[model samples]
Target chain A: MNNRLKILRAERDWSQATLAVHLDVSRQAVNAIETGKHDPSLPLAFRIARLFDLSIEEIFHDQN
Target chain B: MTKIDATHNLSESAPSSVLRKVLITIIGGLTAVFSIAFLAGYTVAVTEQGGLNAYAIGTIAAGLGLIGLTVFISYKLWPKGTHEAVPAREKKSQHILWAAVVIGVLLGGYMAVASGDNPDGVFSNEPVTASFAVISIATWLIIVPIITWMWWRTIDEHEADAYREGALVSAHVYIFLAPTWWMAARAGWAPQQDPMIVLVIVSIVWSIVWLYRKYA
Candidate 1:
């Protein structure tokens, strides 16, 4: 899944570490998601969406 | 946005996914081997050894301790699914794992040799002795510093973490092996003449397999 995570994080002026802390995950996880190296689990996707106060669909779009 | 673009993106992301999949496969394989050996040793020792109660208790305690440690590390170090990739952190994590493996082998070898002779002969009734107990305790002490060093070196102020979780998993495996090692040593499986030649062989094979899987 390609996400605007980097852009969103930048807009919020938050580092990956800050976002990771907020999500209760490791910074590497955030990095993985941002670089499209790893896709987030459903729970984590929900958490990320909730953290940014956006719908999951808005944050993560299915390519297929 | 387009199918072509999506495919391109996926292709671009393939390498890390491949790496993660390979890692998972290797870990799963190791877990299987360790589990089989542990169970076999436990069964053999319980049936063959005299102190069934002590063996059972020791195995359970060691297993639980290892499981707890694995869980703690995983929760602390593993990425939660969103962090950006940091190559440096990944390298550090690999280094920590290598260090742990080296330390574990060294300590195991030391304990195997150090406790070869029954020094005090206190537990003569039992298979093991005061010397074996001392060695086991000493091995635990050595393991602590090695584990701590791995944690300290792998974790960073900014990198997205997933190593602690991985370490925790590794710890659980180690824990499961600890009792078997102790019991085997006590059983004189590692005699002065042969001295756990099988374990040494297995350890060498394990290392080779791990390296092949990881790098080859």
Candidate 2:
């Protein structure tokens, strides 16, 4: 549930909308994920990691 | 309401002069209210007259005219939305939704018009009435639901979540609202219950809440 998605997006100098476009999700979805209001499904998580050119662990951390 | 962009410290003010905006909004609101009143009165008055007359025609025209005026005033006061291009897929899906809506209205309108005065169900033996009845039933029961389901499946997860949240809200509202209406009707303070109309009302609320969650 805890992910550094916001930081990763910022590191790439991307707006949420920009990141959302790449991820094929809404800006609201990206915001919700970053804000920890929702967690991405496994496939989406893989897609996000692939987009960032990192492994899943690099992008997401288990808060549990 | 102010929108705060998290990515940037963006500040946007009203595009029009504040005083002019306020004046236009007030005038537009009054016009819209009057148009609604006229339409309501026309419906009742025209029904009592048992046919279309000068009074009915004039009332309909006046109501429509005021509505047009309000739309014009609203356009002048505040333009609709941003010029951001909706994705082509989204646009296509929106078109589908619009098409379904238009079809539903046409079918429903035909049924209402063909029913004569009181539609005695499919056994009425009236050709136009029976045909429109079948079409309207199919429109609502089959066509509309298919279009809605298609629209729901095509949206992103966030938009779907908005829909889910909307459904939850509507469900909660109906839990209280249906009982209150039933209580009131039982006590003779309200008219008899119509399940179909209540369901329609709930559906409207669901859509409204979904839109608010998506765009708010």
Candidate 3:
């Protein structure tokens, strides 16, 4: 899985830590998701979607 | 910059950040040394060896060398002043965990040194004074459970998942290992299994896997 999390954060001028705080997660968690080492759970995905005011599909995409 | 933005600048090279790096390096180095020593001791015990052999020395040397390399790399890569803001509640939880770990390691080291005269070292069958036994039991049976419960409750979902995966892998290893060692002992092909050694090995495996999942 790949996501535009880094790009999204950068667009908003938000550091990983800033986004992590918004999501109530560790910065490491945000980094892992951004790097594709971890996939967000459904609830987290929803949160991320809500945060960016975009659908989950707009933020995250399957590699295939 | 906003307050949060101020906290995220890694290029500052602040005095506080320098102190943090030094502290991290010291703690990480000590942890690596302790882990290696603990594993080496158990390896010798499990093999029924009398002393450190060439292999043990080589392993220790390699492990220390690796630790040195890791420290160097971490130092090089770490930002000078870029610690991200952790929520206050989560920060408190982290402090408690570190305090517990430090206490545990100190107590363990004290026990090993104090039991120097005992043939079986810290696990000797020799009777301890009543007060010592009470203190030890209280720490292990009461304080440990409370701390463990707090730890489980405080960790985030990612950490919980890492712990679960680590436990699963270690449990499988133990399931196969204990039985094989027992059967071998029965057939006079190996020494009897020691529960303590088995526990240590399993714990090490769990820690390794958990760290990998969390960081890698």
Q: Which DockQ values do the candidates obtain, in the order shown? A: 0.04, 0.22, 0.22
CA lDDT of every candidate: 0.55, 0.66, 0.71
lDDT for model 3? 0.71
Worst 10 residues of 3 chain B by lDDT: B7-16
* Per-residue lDDT of model 1, residues A1-64, tens digit only: 7788877876776666566657765555666687765677788788889998999988887677
lDDT of 3 at A56: 99
Worst 10 residues of 1 chain A by lDDT: A23-32
Error of 3 at B90 (Å): 4.0
Measured against the true structure, the TM-scores of the candidates, in listed sequence, are 0.34, 0.64, 0.69
Per-residue lDDT tens digits for candidate 1, residues B71-174, read: 46544543345334444655566567666656655554443334333322221233655776776677668776767666666554222223333344445555
Q: In the order shown, what is each candidate's alpha-carbon RMSD?
A: 16.7, 7.5, 8.9
- CA displacement after TM-score superposition, residue B173 of candidate 1 (Å): 16
Error of 2 at B109 (Å): 5.8
DockQ of 2: 0.22
Ranking by DockQ: 2, 3, 1
The true-versus-predicted C-alpha distance at residue B46 of model 3, in Å, is 30
